[model samples]
Target: MKFTCEKSILQEGISTAQKAVTGKSTMPILNGILIKAKNNEITLIGSDIDLSIETKIKAEIIEEGNIVIDARLFGEIIRKLPNDVVSINTIENNSIEILCQKSRFTLIHMNGEDFPLLPSINENMIFSVPQRILRNMIKSTIFATAQDETRPILTGVLFEINNNNLNLVALDGYRLAVRSENLSTDNVISAVIPGKTLSEVSKILEEDDENVNITFTPNHILFNLGYTKIISRLLEGEFIRYNSIIPEEYNLKVIAKRGDLLHCIERASLMAKDGNTNLIKLSMEEENMIITSNSQLGMVREELNIILQGQSLQIAFNSKYLIDVLKIMEEEEIVMEFSSSVSPCVIRNKEINNCTYLVLPVRLLNS
Candidate 1:
């Protein structure tokens, strides 16, 4: 294959496709990028069996052919090249030459025919969502996915779309997160996307209002942009019935500024981290809330003004769990609800119910 393209354009396409290349693959070809030059366009593909990414960029094609080049080496070369057009040509003896300005290098190339093919997904079961919205949805819930593989399904995010509403749900047994958004389609989709795949997809998606097309199959999901596409395998199993686990009402509710509550917990977490259990206690009095943490080395107390309703309560929780949710929240104020100290703590946006967070409190011996 022979092609000439601007360095920036080539670098972006290479970087995007390289996301799927894992160097640990047993098949050496899987660690390289499959490059196809034809029709004034250069196509780059990277895959690691379960995930694949393909991207295309316009280039001046002198000869239409295909070759596989090392993804890491090609990316580094293109990125370091001067701000000029780069030329790549297949040389004799299974090698390719790269040239830009005064720099030139030759590298061994693999036959593109040996590369695995990406799955073909039909367009029947498809939906369109804005890129920015999809990115936000992934960010809001991906953190809650289970890190351990004891239950494989919990390591993925549950995507459910029905009745013109899309919901993303994730839980790690200890905490749960749900993010919902309105849709303009009538199609229904239910699938569990691996958290690792969503994490990579979010990085490629631009924070823009432009739509990204999504197509789902029984065993795989496809994300199709105009110039790029991502294909990932779907996890096979039934997800937990999350709806039944979440409580519908609470006997105690506390409304406080998000920043104030977050800062208080963070300060208390210092002492909690010094302790064995990393526990922080909260005392909800009539008009204010007090947070305290104690360790062998020291102890700390923080007080914040809050509006409490229903009943006075005291609770304990893992400081890191609360911090995880608080750092990502985009609201000025937050609402915390509880039925009892042993019950799960529910958090929500001050104005909307579109987002929900549930953190199981650490049982205090004194409670």
Candidate 2:
């Protein structure tokens, strides 16, 4: 394969595709990028069987051919080269030549035929949402996905579509984050997409109103973004029946300034961090909420004025869990509903129901 293109264009395509490269020593072909030159376009693809990212860039195709080159080495070379037109050509002995402003290099290229074929989804279940909306949905819930591999299904976020609403649900054993958005689709679809794959797609998605078309298959999910597309295998197995776990009603409801509560817990967690459990207690009274933490080194006590309703109660939780939810929330004020100190605390936007976060509290020992 031979092609000449601007450095910036080539660099971006390589960088995006490189993210999907899984250099499994056992399969060297998986580490190489498949490059095809035709129709005055250069298509670059990188894949690891499970996740694949492909991008197309306009380039002058001199000799129409295809080759697979080492993703890491090719990316490093193109990135460091001068910002000028780059020319590449395949030579004898299965090697390729690279030339730029004044630099030159030659590397052995792998046979493109050996690369695994990327799964194709044709005329599948197609739906789309604004890029910004999808990006925001992923960021708000991805953090709650379980990091441990104990339950593989829990490591992926659930993409559920029912009626005209889309919900992204993620849960680690201790916390749950659910972000919802309204769309114009009436199709019901459910898929468990890996968090790692979704995170990469989020990086490539532009924060604009442009829609990203999504195609779903029984075994795969594809995110098609005009010039680029991401394909990932669906995680097998059933996800937790989340709807049954959350309480329908709470004994107490408290409305407080999100920033004020977040800051108070942050300061108190400093002391709580030193203890085995990152515990913080919230003592809610008729007119005031007291935040306190006890540790081996010291204790911290802070107070915030809150609007209380229903009843007054006290609850204890891990400071980190609350901090995660508060940091991602964009609203000025938040609503917290508590069934009891032992039950989970439900946090939601004060004025809207776009997002719901549930945090399981750490049991407090009687002293």
Candidate 3:
């Protein structure tokens, strides 16, 4: 393939597609990116069996052809190219030459026929959501997804669409994060999308108000974002019944400033970080909440003014878990509900019910 394109445009296309390139795959073709040039447009594709990314950029095509080149090498060369325009040409012996200003390099190309075909979704179950909103939904819940592969279902976020409401749920057994948004659809759909894939999608999404078209099938999901498309396999297993696990009732409610609580927990976690458990104790009294942590390194205690109601309680939790949810919240104040020191603590926005985070309290020996 021969094409000449602006360095910035080429770099972005290659960078986005490189996300799906398999790093240590047994198939050599999977490590390379497929480049296809035709009709003034060049497409870059990368796949790792489960996930694939393809992006197109406008180019000056001299010779319309297709070739597969090492993704890492191609990306590096494009990023370091010292000119505004870059020219790529395929030569004899399965090699491609890259030229920009005074710099030139040749890279051996792989057979494009060996690359696996990306699954195409032609189903009628397609929906669209604002890219910014979808990106926010993924970021808010993806951190709660389980990293362990033992229960593969929990490694993905549950996408539940009922009528116009869309709920995204992610839980790693210890914490559950749920984010809800309203869509303009009436279709009912449910799918378990891998969290890793969602994370990558979030990275490439633009911050503007553009809408992303999502197509879903029985075993795969496709996202079309203007010039880029991503396809990923859906996890096949029943996700845990998350709604039933969320506590319906709590006797104690504490409303506190999010920034104050976040800062206190961050300071408390510093001491706890030295230990294996990273435990921090929260004691809610009449009008104040005290956070304390003790470890082999040292101890930290912080007090924040809070509006407490219902009943007083003391609970211990992994400091990291609390910080994770609190850091993402945009509200000025947050509500924490607790049935008891042993029950799961629910944290949410004080004004809106758009998001909810449930964290299981760590058991104390004395309790």
Candidate 4:
């Protein structure tokens, strides 16, 4: 394959596709990025069996051919080269040569046929959502996904569509995050997307307000946006029935500034760090909340006054868990509902809309 292209264009595509490249692989071809040039367009593809990302860039093709080159090396080289045009050609013995300005480098090529075919979804459920909205949904829920490999299904986000609503949920036993958005789709479909894959997808998506078409099949998913299309394999198994676990009633409700609560919990977490899992104590009184954490070294405490209604109660939770909820919360104020110290603490937006964060509390002296 031979192609002369703008260095900036080639570099951008390589950087995006390199995210899917398998860093450690037994098969050498899996570590390389497939470059195919034809009909004046160049396509770069990288995959590691489960997740594949492909992007295309306009190029002036002198010869129509294909070659596989190491993704990491190609990205690194192109990124450091001058912003001039780049020339690439495959010569005898399957060595790909790169020429930019006065610098010359050669990359070893692998057989393209050995690379595994990416999963394709055809005639599957399709929906479109604003790129920024989808990115926000994943940010709010993906962090709650379980990392334990024992239950592989829980290690990903559960995406459910029903009656014009799209919901994404993640739980790791200790905490759960649920977010929903209204869409025009009436078709029903549910799939588990691995947390790692979704994280990469969110990162690759540009910050523009463009819309992305998401399609799901029984065994695969495809996200089409801009000049790149990403395909990821779906995890097999039944996702846990998550709705049953959420509490429907709580006697106490407290609303406070998002920033104030976040800082209080963060400070408490520092003291709680010496303990197991950084446990913090939350005492909800008539119209105020006291946040405290104690360890052998010292104890930290703070209070945040808020508007409240109903019975007073106290609860204890992992400080890190509360901080995680605050990290993704975009509202100015948040509401916390408490049933009891032992039951889950439900945190939601004060406006009674958008997402819910259910966090299991840790045992405290209140016991």
| Candidate 2's TM-score | 0.98
Q: What tens-digit string does per-residue lDDT give for candidate 4 at 182-289?
A: 988768989999999999999987666798999988888899986999998888999988889889998888889999999999998989888467888888887789
**Model 2 agreement with the true structure over 92-128: per-residue lDDT tens digits:** 9999999997899999999888888999789456788
Cα RMSD (angstroms) for every candidate in the order listed: 1.0, 1.2, 1.3, 1.3
Candidate 2 off by > 4 Å: none
Best by TM-score: 1
User: How many Å off is the CA of 266 in candidate 3?
Assistant: 1.3
TM-score of 4: 0.97
Score each candidate by Cα lDDT.
Answer: 0.93, 0.92, 0.92, 0.89
Please write out the lDDT profile of model 3 over residues 1-367, one tens digit for every residue.
7889999999999999999885878888988999999999998999987889999999999999888989998898899988589999988888998999989898899877777888877946668889999999999999999999999999999999996989999999999999999977878988999998888889988887899999988898999997999999999999999999999999999999999899999999989987468899999999999999998767888999999989999999999999999999989999999998889999999998899999999999999
Q: Which stretches of candidate 1 lie over 4 Å from their true place?
A: none
TM-score of each: 0.98, 0.98, 0.97, 0.97
Write down the TM-score for model 3: 0.97
